[model samples]
Target: MAVIIKHNELEYAAKESAISEFALLTGKKQSGAEKHMKYDIRMLEAGRFSFPYHFHRNSEELFVILSGCAVLRTPTEFFEVHEGDVIFFEMGPDGAHQLYNHTAEPCRYLDLRTVSGLDVCEYPDSGKINILPEQEVYQTGDQVDYYQGEAQVRDKWPESVLEKSR
Candidate 1:
């Protein structure tokens, strides 16, 4: 079966932040979509940005410009994208991106991504990583070595326990 939804039918909700004012189409809820991927439509007002510069560790994402124009910032470059443009972002630091609507009118784009049980997102500018599903945010520099807290074990099993098994 196929799911069909018109853009006009999408319910938009305001998402306010320090750097942007936008509306988001909650596709998962609207379509009752689950499993492989998730979709969202982000509508950004002129001079507003979509989100912070960040990259995912577990999933890739694709963006398609639905209307108007915007400036897209990747780790190494900035691109002026217009309607019908499609962009793919791989999972990594190299894929970090931010989209800003610099045109005088609003811009809309589809944000699609793979669904993952766990996702780690890195925010380079903030020196933080967001662990999803658990929704924990931690400073990148605060990592502890893997075995840092393990207690030293001198023997594989205690003598009394081993004797009882024998």
Candidate 2:
């Protein structure tokens, strides 16, 4: 079934940080979309950023500016974005981005992304990779060697098992 929702009908939550303040539309809760790609609206306050510079390993994202203006920062460049602008971000480091609204008024944009069972999000500025759903954050330098926690087995198989197989 197609879902129809008014902008005002969606609940909004405020996310505040030292460098940013924004309202995010709670689309999943309102529309009951679980498996499908998610869509939410972010209304960023003036002089605030939408999010940190980051990229997703398993999901793609797109943004549509509904109103106002902001500066979009990518891995190598910063560009001005305004109303009616459509932006697509592919999965991985090349797609890393952040948006800052420098205008006096609010900047509204639709945040859309593919649904993934698990996602690894890298925050370059913080040197952290966030494993979503499980919600674990680890610094890039914190990576441990594989099998670091596993108990070592001296032999490939037990003698009894090998005899039985023979």
Which candidate comes out best when scored by lDDT? 2
Candidate 1: tens digits of C-alpha lDDT, residues 13-54: 776445435333333235565678887877877877777789
Q: Write the per-residue lDDT of candidate 2 for residues 1-166, one digit (tens) a residue.
A: 7777676665667764454253333333456654868878778777777777899999999999988999999999999999999999999999999998888988888998997689999999999999986879899988888888666553667888878867
RMSD (CA, Å), candidate 2 to true, equals 3.0
User: Which ranges of candidate 1 are over 4 A from the true structure?
Assistant: 16-29, 152-166
TM-score of 1: 0.83
**Candidate 1 lDDT score at position 98:** 89
Quality of model 2 by C-alpha lDDT:
0.82
Scored against the true structure, residue 84 in model 2 reaches a CA lDDT of 100
Candidate 1: residue 104 Cα off by (Å): 1.8
Error of 2 at 25 (Å): 6.6
